[model samples]
Target: MNSGEVIDVTRDAIVTFLKVGGPMLVVALLVGVAISLLQALTQIQEQTLVFVPKILALAAAALFAMPFMGDAMASYMTRIAERIAGG
Candidate 1:
């Protein structure tokens, strides 16, 4: 692939990755922020308290988003494969 093509492919790959991970990441971030606020207010500095909820929330988000992520990745792969074959 030429430089432009390579860049396009890389960009697409990154976009695909972000699309797949975005929901889970957002959930984790929101949960973390909320937990941080709660901890601050309560003055409870338990490490597990912060981590466990975020992890569980992220896991749940990932599970719920799995089908959509799979479809997006599959579409991206199909497009990339078609481009490669055409070239």
Candidate 2:
């Protein structure tokens, strides 16, 4: 593949990665922020308090998003295969 093809592939890979991972990251960020705010308001100040909730939120998000993520990755792989076969 040429430089342009390489760039295109790289860009697609990044987008695919974002699509697959964005939901969990967003969930984690939101959960962390909410936990931080709660802690600030209640004066809890417990450093370990955030881990369980964040992990649970991320797990739920991943479970909910799994089908969409799978479809996106499958389509990306299909595109890659088509490109390879075309060349």
Per-residue lDDT tens digits for candidate 1, residues 1-77, read: 78999999999999999999889888988998999999999999888897788878888888899999999999999
Local distance difference test, each candidate: 0.91, 0.96
TM-score of 1: 0.91
Model 1 lDDT on a 0 to 1 scale: 0.91
* Candidate 2 ranges with C-alpha deviation above 4 Å: none
Model 2, span 1-87: residue lDDT tens: 899999999999999999998888899999999999999999998999999999999988988999999999999999999999999
Which candidate achieves the best TM-score against the true structure? Answer: 2
Model 2: ten consecutive residues of lowest lDDT:
20-29
Clashes of each: 0, 0
Q: What overall lDDT, based on C-alpha atoms, would model 2 receive against the true structure?
A: 0.96
